[model samples]
Target chain A: MRVDVRALGACNRLAERGAERAADALADLTGTDLAVEVTGASVASGEDLAEAFAGRESIGVSVGLDGGLDGEAVLAFDSQQADALLSLLPGGASMGRSAVTEVGNIALGGFLDGWANYLGQAIDMTPPRYFEADGAAVLPDGALAGDGVFLFESRLDATTTDLDFSIYMLPDSGPFRDLVVGKTATAATPGAEGAAEGTGDAGSTVVPYESLSTFASLAKRGSTNAADNIGMMTGLDTTVEVSRLRFVPLADVPAEVGVEPHAGTVFELQGEPSGYLAILFEEESAAAVAASMLPTEPDDPLGDMAENALCELGNVMTSGFIDGWANVLGTSIAHSPPEFVHDIGSATISPIVAELGRRQDYGFVIDAAIQTEGVQAQCDVYALPDERELAAALSRLSET
Target chain B: MSHPSSAGGRDASGSARRVAVGVGDLAVVDGDAALTTSGLGSCVAVALVDPTTGARGLLHAMLPSADDSQSSRPSARPAKYVDSGVDALIDELGAAGASPNRLEARLVGGAEMLDLTAAVGPRNVERAERALADAGIPIVARDVGDGVGRTVRYRPNGELAVRAADGFERTL
Candidate 1:
């Protein structure tokens, strides 16, 4: 089914509004100041979603939904913040998991209320189920089994206290598709713009929902190609850990990539789907990966020789990345020579995102994580494709 | 992974209240409180401080101007754009009992970080400077136009500390 860009933007905005409302509810209940720091609608495979929260220890509540929406929603708290969150409850720190569950229930209710109001139908929710484990375990079973799932994720922060939480909504494909399909159909009807009126520019392309999954697979292949190139260059066993497409607000792009210091190379892709690409590694990983490239370990991992080696690796990987997209779309894609950068993760991406933010409020970030088996070496490859051009390319692929 | 502590409530003097200003957001505080924002690349952090009144406002803006944005209407988050964000910061400090004429601006961030791209960093810095100039607000100090990301912390006492990712720290 085709989904109009306008409809998706509207849904994204609603998700933000709903998360804000949820934060308000939590604030009201706990008597603490809270805010929604970031919100975005994303398309990712189960493995990608799992990988996102796999390492961190978290506690959360999951609930099933029906009526206006059919899906499962998970509200997770960083376990370290659990004490702060628990302290806000009337029962105080002694309440523990039950209080956490109640907070989740109220926040999810407030969250779904916006969607329900928009759909003009009540969304019934099942009782909250509490889960405490590593990040991925918070998600219900079978959530990690899908090829692609539409997810609305938001991060909430508390101002007065050191508390924060994340809400992840996994909507069932059939019902979610129907929702988008219906909204887009209405958006296309003359004089019935409704929800889609204020969101999109005129003449936006409509992309088939399934095509997003195809693009995800395309990203996976590209990342796999990159991993193979890394293996060939470093002679280390490297593999693609996760690959997914995330649609996020332009302003949040930097924070999404993260704030930690990173060593990377940046390139600009020039072609049918011209955009920017960044291949980043944590400091230690960068050192390890760079050292593996040279005959002997470099005296300084970020010195001239290591920087050149990393740039060369980034060049081949950039080729491996866009080459998949180029082959599949039957178009030629060229990339600028790499620009070596070793700085805060967000700093490396904000300029690119800011440039894109001038014309588009949202960005399609194709993210991939590559890991070397025997060392503390990991790489994060981000490919931000020109949204309109990518939509056009994907639509053409669907047509074929 | 754990979040980077936006909580910088402790200093040499004593314990102070801390507020974090996230991306495309702003915050204003008075008295023994500090305002902080981090991970600023091309995004500019504009701080308005009234040393006389001990009131301060911080804006973390991503884009130069909302006028240049695709949307024609004013954004709900006015602080997301520098021109409007500076205006909002001035107005907020005014509400906090700091006279608009008494406010002096100190800027941080606006780094290009990566080379040969659209010059959003320079544009953001220029836009902020113009906005402060237009409002008859003088810019007291600034640390900008570099290839680095910064985390900034401002206290009402007129101390604006900026720490670059490369372990360089400066008080503007």
Candidate 2:
């Protein structure tokens, strides 16, 4: 089914219902919900919600929620976890595609299916897509409106591993529902004023999920999170899938100009003159990736194909990370293109090397290991921080 | 199993032990040989240890070389910037006759924070590589670059185990 105007209206009401249902579901899933005192919860980032999966890696059945906002869901499982989750299935990764997609299809199906049955509203859902990483840059645009976005999140500890999902909804305030239900009295005359009145506050226009509690006046639960309804949890929501976006371009460089002094460059944090840092993969991995890419190896090559792939892979992932940071924080930043290096001799590295070695100023560091179809990539991210935001990230649990 | 810490013994004759330091800011000692440094990322860390005395040191760098010179002690600040940090390390080790020939090294970090068209992570990592190559020390082991931030540790005696995105740590 597709999302139509009437269907959109129904989806909106169902999403409203979800808010109320989410709070209760969370209280039940967390077991410690009574201790889970709802903080003011004025704001939360997609990253904060995503990071919830750190260290707890055996998560299968990835789920993505692309509703009325630019938010996503990611659930990854290790190979063993994937195998067990897809028990009695066919062969390897390829054979498991349908089985994995089924997980998301079922999870989403449960939500919409239950909503349609309970509210008797005609809400439709799109087929779930597989996500390797949290696609912050590719999130549906123009999905949100107004100010005061609210972010609500909950975690569930299932039989073996844990499961979690965040529902990001925007409150498009209007008097339509009230007018339709209240003014449509028997023998009552129609009034244009009643229908035209609007909650025109700019904040009221684009309410974020985190700020939903503030908009409790307008926003309500959209669908009930199937916490108490464990019977409905029969839907699938676990699997591991991988997608690699590689740019294959064949370019030749002069043999004389072989040294690419600036081949692998990454992150550019903002400071006075300039501030930046990048890690260069040792020569072996560069050679490994090159061996996989090239048919023949030449002496003193212009640039190793493996190094190029490795660096560019870093570039894409880091670029995507920057975009994710900007989108979630609703901020903007500039960065340099990535460069690669081979046979870079070892040297002692110091923290002060980047920030000029002063503890007075320190940046946040993120170390992650990324595994694609045939490549293993490692990268780090740093973001300078101060008070409020710092506290939040330190408090973030942001991957799932 | 982890390597045994043989960084015992104090200042010795010309015989200095080999050391590969990890991520962190502290001096490591293995007999008389000593190296000091930090890893790089959007955040930087340095490692330092002595081979003759089995001492080492490191510091992870974050900002550029200039910011570190903001107000730190002239000598104390050199080991902070990539350019001067290496110089300071060499000079400090030189006090014990640690020559370029006897000195062997390994480095890590300098992962970027943002990946704009002209980010700084690559630049910093590049400069560190260039500076070290010019200094004549072959990099024994390193897990650095565009991918992920690493918490690299150094072993002054054997090889430093690098634990990061990849589960198994390797000695470099």
All models, DockQ values?
A: 0.41, 0.06
Which residue ranges in model 2 land beyond 4 Å of their true spot? A1-264, A269-302, A343-352, A355-361, A379-400, B1-172
Query: What share of the reference contacts survives in each candidate?
Result: 0.70, 0.13
lDDT of 1 by residue, A1-400 (tens): 6766545565776788789789989989998878787787777777776776667898999999999899899898888888878888989988888898899999999999977877778999999999887867776555678777777888888877888888888878888888876765554332222354333453455788777777666676677787788788777788765546667666667777777888989999999788888888888878877777788888887898899988988987889888878877767889999999888888888888877766666666665556665655667677777777887888888788
Candidate 1 has which clashing residue pairs, if any? Answer: none
lDDT by residue (B70-111, candidate 2, tens digit) is 432232224335666665566655664565555666666666
lDDT, candidate 1, residue A131?
88
lDDT of 2 by residue, A331-386 (tens): 45345666443222122122223333342222223333333335443322222322
Q: Just chain B of model 1: what TM-score?
A: 0.90
> Candidate 2, residue A249: CA error in Å?
39
CA lDDT of each prediction against the hidden true structure? 0.79, 0.36
Instruction: Give the residue spans of candidate 1 off by over 4 A.
Output: A6-10, A16-40, A45-60, A76-104, A114-121, A130-147, A155-166, A181-202, A365-367, B1-14, B70-76
Q: Count the backbone clashes (under 3 Å) in each candidate.
A: 0, 167
RMSD values, in order shown: 4.9, 20.6
